[model samples]
Target: MTDQPAIELNNGVRIPQLGFGTFQVDSDETQRIVETALEAGYRHIDTAAGYYNEDGVGAALKASGLARDDVFLTTKLRNGDQGHDSALAAFEASRKALDVDVVDLYLIHWPTPTRWLAPETWRAFEKLLADGAVRAIGVSNFLPHHLGRLLETAGVTPAVNQFEIHPTHQQPAVQDASRAAGIAVEAYAPIGKGEDLSEEAVEAIAQAHDVSPAQVVIRWHLQQGRIVIPKSATPERIRSNIDVFGFELTTGQLDALTGLERANRLFPNPDEFEASQFRD
Candidate 1:
């Protein structure tokens, strides 16, 4: 009965467009919070090794007693593990931590171009795909130039390019590049994490639809064809975020949200970010 739609990747893998994310979610609370998300009807769950909560995510899944295939799971490699050998080892560890024989989707986490090492790391990703260790491979936080460099010798075009995208900071240039290359764009920090929830257009649209501003913003992303993952630790908000299927936005309302774009990119610029995932 869930109204979530699935988008087909270039490699023929279908992913749920609406998902629950555990970015800043704490490890101790991840299991319960994720279990709530599952019970609330979220079939897609996004976690990462860098998030330090993959074990909790796995526990939540186990506790729900849902078939492994019943949910689409996605995780990313830490920036610290960006070489062929290291990436391979990291994937194995992540798979073990999540207790999945084959991961639904695996991403490079960030271009963090040592991304001189990106091609090398990508080779490992290709190997994983070839060995059937993962269903699909993609990148996160990549820009046009980053994508360009990665594609120069890329054997498989990335199936997705996840990054920070919201009403206030839409990376149209990046989105255009990814779409043109047939790579799906997935939005992270999709609601600006409350940064722009009070924008005039968003507020107006929400008021008109009798929905929360977060829902208005999420609906905007869905209508425009971007895969969005919104996170909330609170049970009510988690359910509320996914309740977007109940309403539709008019073209004007959609455009109003579009007009709110300031091209204000958040997060580290992939071109210059050199930090790696911190190890405990």
Candidate 2:
């Protein structure tokens, strides 16, 4: 049995605190890799339309033989597909691609604020939740200001706010804002995509715990009460990623990891980023 705990969202949906992510996992390899993650005891899987691997994720889910409700699946609307009508259409396409009648959580992939489309797109997500097409709705890469703007007229408070969070990018303001708004925080790139795993503090914690640095980081996220999704296609790492429930970090170690934060962000600022930059 999986030892991962679940955190309740504002909408009362409980999501696994630790999950498997399929960000850069190629579409061709997603099926086998995702299946491996499931076999390794990951009950939650994070995917997105822009990842271009929903079909493969769907195939793995079908092949896993687990009941549909046994897994918590999350997918996002592509940044290129914003606005009310396009967002609705994109959700339909993603639903078909994932072969699911209703996804557990659906998210706006990015605010793309330059397009001024997040509020419009969020309206579409609200409709999906109301229609029972999705169990929960949230946004990714959104900061407090973005959320503040959306909340002014939003019919529903977002259940979660997912963003790039790691030891090097703690985002205290965002975390505080989300907590004030009663939105759960979900951390993507929880280990900074293997960037800071070798750092002195992380390694020191790893050594003390007799675990890998990645595990220490994952545990750190958990200790902070944020949901974390760490991705890996390799079988060994995939299994080891889910083994974090066995250890707990000391308060001093947790503080050390917190001290590693330099507010370093690896992605474009949502307020300034445009979806067109990703196009050929």
Candidate 3:
């Protein structure tokens, strides 16, 4: 119950402007951490099947005693499960793990061009959307070329394109392509892995606002109208991460952060990522 603004997706579903992420959260500790996030006013949560913590997220939601409609939940398909039937089955597994009848947003975890199975996997995603299993469907880690190829056979344009976006690694081309197609842009690792928070530009802005560098970076994403998800295992950091609505950044500060971009992409190339990340 916070004053977070909601962004409407291409399909009319609204999502929180900021969210808590469970990327590296261990399943053994996810429930406690997520419950902490919930208590800190994070109404949006992002998880993935590959993260192996949906059950914990579901446990946290149930433990919080919040109504189903009170939160927006998102999860992603595992890279290995990239086919019509496999993807559909994977969704069922994720749904059951999360204990949700309908997922707010379901994303194909990666483009996995090497697999040559994304188009087929997207068919399953369309089926899920049509069948009302998910409120919206999208993809993550996709670049412009990936989106272009998927668009060739996709009947439903993705509602969102989430990727690693930070002060240092802004993907302008992908952002342009996604927005051009009416898809919302979501940022992961918004504060960057390590070096971003310590940068002079970010630190100077933080000093001006009297906030943490992470908060300043998060604010930069929010002020730009982009959805941001920042993850933390610490309670103080988790609460502090969402307390970014108290102040704003000036145009000069925002431009300074934008000027920090050096194409420092931190993730693997989607095209070269093998479809089967893990084997049975």
What TM-score against the true fold does each predicted structure earn? 0.98, 0.97, 0.98
Query: What's the TM for model 3?
Result: 0.98
- Show model 1 residue runs off by greater than 4 Å: 1-3
Let me know the TM-score candidate 1 reaches against the reference structure: 0.98
Model 3 residue runs over 4 Å out of place are: none
Note the clash tally of each candidate.
1, 0, 0
Per lDDT, what order, best first? 3, 1, 2
Q: Tell me the lDDT of model 1 at 125.
A: 98
Please state the error at residue 268 of candidate 3 in Å.
Answer: 1.0
lDDT of each: 0.92, 0.91, 0.93
Candidate 2 residue spans exceeding 4 A from truth: 276-279
Q: For candidate 2, lDDT tens digit of each residue in 120-159? A: 8888989999999999999888989999998987899999
lDDT by residue for model 1 over 1-280, one digit each (tens)? Answer: 2567999999999899999999989999999999999999999999999999999999999999899988999999999999999999999999999988989899998888654789999999999999999999999999999999999999999999999999889999999999999999999999897987999888988999999999999999999999999999999999999999989999999999999888776777877887788765
